[model samples]
Target: MKEKLSRKLAQNVEALKDIFQDSSDLVYRDIQFTESRRGLIVYVEGIINVDLVDQNIISPLIEGLVKAEKPVERLSELPFTRISLTQTSTASDWPGVIEAILTAHVVIFMDDSDEVLTFDVKGGSRRSVQEPSTETVIRGPREGFTESLRINTALLRFKLKTEKLKMKPLIVGKITKTDVVVSYIDGLAKQDLVDSVLDRLKQIDMDGILESGYVEEWIEDNPYSPFPQMQYSERPDTIAAQLLEGKVAIFVDGTPFVLVAPVTLWQLLQSSEDYYERYFVTNFIRWIRLFFLLVALMLPGLYIAVTTYHQDMLPSSLILSIATAREAIPFPAIIEALIMEVSFEALQEAGIRLPKTIGQAVSILGALVIGQAAVQAGIVSAPIVIVVSMTGIASFTLPRFNLATTVRMLRFLIMILAALFGLFGIVVGTVWILVHLTQLKSFGVPYLLGVSPYRLRDFKDIFVRVPMWKMSQRPNSSSETNRNRIGAPKLRGRADEHEGW
Candidate 1:
C-alpha cells in the first residue's frame, strides 16, 4: 500500500519525485529560514500562474516565517493570509499531494510536519471570450463560452442569477481527470431526468476523454442512430434559454461547446434569433426553413423519380428542355445525379477542411469551373448541376450541423431508392424515415415529441412560434410542472414582463 507523507521534508520530497518520475516541468523550490528550519514548494512549471505563486504564496510565506518570534506549526499561527482561507487546504496522504500538484495547486512541505499546505494558484494560457464562430446572430449577446470551465459557468450565472440555478460538478476520465458540470434549475428540471443523466454519465468508465464528443458518444441512448440526441451550443444565451425550458446542460472542460439534452426535431429547426425577432417575421422565416428542409432531403430523389419513370407528369416544354440538356449525356439520370451530388459534397468538405482565407473562394470557383466543364464535356447535364446546387444550398439552411449532416447522408439513400423504384421508391424511403423518427428517443423523450405524439399544449411553438405571451407553458417533455413563464400569460403583462410584442 502507498504511504502517507512523512515528517521529514527530505523524505517527502524524494517520494513525490519518485511518483512524478521523468517530469521535467515539476518545480521544487527549497526555502531555508534557519539551520534546522526548511521548506519546499512544489508545482508544475507551466500550468500555474508563476507570478501569483511568487507574489502571493512564496513571498508571503517566507516573510511570515522569518519574522515569526517562534516556530509556527499550524496555518493560523502564520501572520500572512493573503490567500483566501477557502482556497487553502491541508492534506497528508500521497494521493492527495499528487492530485493537488497535478491540478495546478501549490504545495508547501515543512521540515518536521506530516501535513502539507496547498494553495489554489491554477492558471495557464487560455483563449479569451470571443463571438462563437459556429453559431452567429445579428441581435444577441456577442460573447461566447471560452475553453475555461469556470468562465463558461460564470457566463451562465451572469444570465441566470437565481438561487435555484445549480451546477453539479463531476470528474470523468481516470487518466485525463476531465471536469464535467451538469447545470440545471433545480425545481424546473424533472427529478427523474436529472437522475437518468447522472446515471449515464457516472457509468462512463473511459480512461481518457479528450473532448465533449467522447462523453456524448458514451452517454447517448443509441450508438447506431445518426441523429444527434443532444444539441451543442457555443453561445451562453442558447444554453441559458435551454436551461430555462428545464433541460440539462453538460459542460466538459477544455471545450466551448456545451451539450443540452432531450432535444426534439422542432428544437433542431429553431434558431437562437427566433425569440429575439418579431413573431410574424420569425414565423415567415421558420416556414421558409421548413420548406427548404424538405428540399434538402427530397429534392434530388424527386428529380430522379420524375424524369426516369414519371416523365408524363411534367409539362411538354419543361420535359423537352430537360431532354435537350441531357441528350448529349451518356449516363442515365441516377448516375448523373450521383456524380454531381458526390462532387458537391466533396467540395463542401474540402472547403471546411481548408484554410479560411482560400476555402470560400475554392468552393465557389471549383463548383463553377467543374460544373461548366462537365456540362461542356457532356459528362453531366446542366439540369442535374442546377438540381445538385439547389439541394446543397437548401442543406446549408439547417440551423444545426448534426441535423444537416443527417439530412445529407439520408439524401444519398433516398436517391438510390428513387433510381430503382422511381416515385414509389421515394415514397418508401420517406415512410421509413418518418417511422424511424417517430420511434427515436432522446433521453426518453420522443424525437418528434410535439408532432408525432401531438401534444396540443406544446403546439404553440412547433410549426409556428406563437407570440411570447401565448407560449406561457413550457413543453411537457422538458417541464410538466411549474410551466408558467409569465403569470396568466393571456391576461396581459405589466411593464417588467416585456410582453409588448
Candidate 2:
C-alpha cells in the first residue's frame, strides 16, 4: 500500500494512515489552496517546525493560488519563490516520502498530482551543546557534540573548514532507518582504510542502532577481544583532532558520542588535555598514567604472589609488618585479596547505577565502612585492604572508561594465576597479555603502533608530548603519504639573528 503514492488525496491519506497506524503524532491538515484546487499536508507533530510550515509553505501556496486567475492541477505551475524555504524537493514514491517525513520534513500532496513536495524544516526540542563530562579540558573549547546529527556535523565543519573534509551519509537499520555519517579528510586518510570502514559498516545487519557503541561492536576489527578497538568521544574537538590525524569518525544519529577508528592502546591512555597543556606537564602526566595503568592491572596479583610464595623476596621488616597485620586472618592471601576486590568492585558498580546525589557518597562511605569493619572483624587483613584500595585508585587514572574496565577484568584473571603459581604465574599472565596486545589490530592498524612497531616519529606524541615545533610530521601510524604537518622551522628568531650576524 505504501509502495506508490495515489493521485487522489483521500486515497494517499488512507495509505499513510495504514502505514502509521495508531500513531497519533502523525498530523493531517486539509488545505483549500483555492475554492476549486485542494491538497493535504502531512507531518509528525512535535518534530515539525509549525511556524515555518504555516508562514512559508501554507501561506505562499494559499495566497498564490487564490490570486491566480486560472486553476492548476499541479503545484509546480505556481511560483514557489515567494516562500522562504531554502530546501524543497519532490518525492514520488512512498518510501522516499515517508523517510523524509520521519526525518522532520513536511510533505504536501496535491489533489491531482502524484508527486509530493517535501520541505526541510527540521526544528524541535533538543539538548543544547554543553561541556563534555568525559573529555574535559582546561585550555580548549568547551563545546561538545549534541544528540542532533546535523549539529554534530556542523560542529565538525566549524573546526575543520577545509574542502578536503568530507562527510558521506548512509542510512542503516531496517525498522528505524537511523542516519549515520562517515567523516574524514579526503586525501589524508588512507583510501583502503576508509573503504574497509565503509565495507564493515555497510554489512551491519541490526534491528536498530541505539548508540555509537552498537555500530562499534559490529564494525570493529575484533569483536571477541575484551579490549576496545574503537575509541568513542563526546567532544567535537577530539573528533576533529582524530580526523585531521587521518582517522575516520562515524557520527550516529540520536547519540552524542561519535566513534573514531583504528585506535591504538597508547591512544587509549591519552586524554584531550594532554595536547592542550604544555609539553613538560603533559609528559609528566603521561608517565604517571602509564605507572598507574600497570598498577591497576598487576597490583593485586603482585601483592598476592609476594605475600603467599615470594615472602623471602620482601625485606625482613616489611614481611614482619605484613605478618603482624595478617596474624588473626585465617584466609589465604588470594582469598583475602579477592574478598576486598570483589567488595570494591561491587561498590563501584553500585555508585554508577545509583542516582548521582548519593552515588559518590555511597561508594566512598561503603568502602571505608566495609574496610574498617572487616579489619576489626579479622575477616580480612589490613594490608589486603590497602592493596585493593590502591588498585581501585589506579584504575581511575585511565582516561577511557572502556580501557579501565578492560584493566579491571584482566586484574582478576591475573589474580587467579597469581593464586596458583605465585610470582611465576604473574609473569606468565603478563607475557600472555603483552602477546595479545601485540596481536590486536584495530581496522588492520597495529594496536601498539608506536611501542611495538618501534616508530621513533610516532613515539614523539605517544610516550611523551614533544614540543609542537619538534613534531613536524604526523604519526606514521596514520599511513599518510603527506606526513609533514609543519614545515621546517623558519629563520625567525635566533636563526635570523645568527644570519644577520
Q: TM per model?
A: 0.96, 0.96
Expressed as tens digits, the lDDT of each residue in 122-194 for candidate 1 is 7889899999999988888899998989889999999999999999999999999998999999888898889
Tell me the lDDT of candidate 2. Answer: 0.90
Off by over 4 Å in 2: 491-501
Off by over 4 Å in 1: 74-76, 490-501
- Number of clashes in every candidate structure? 0, 0
Indicate the TM-score of model 2.
0.96
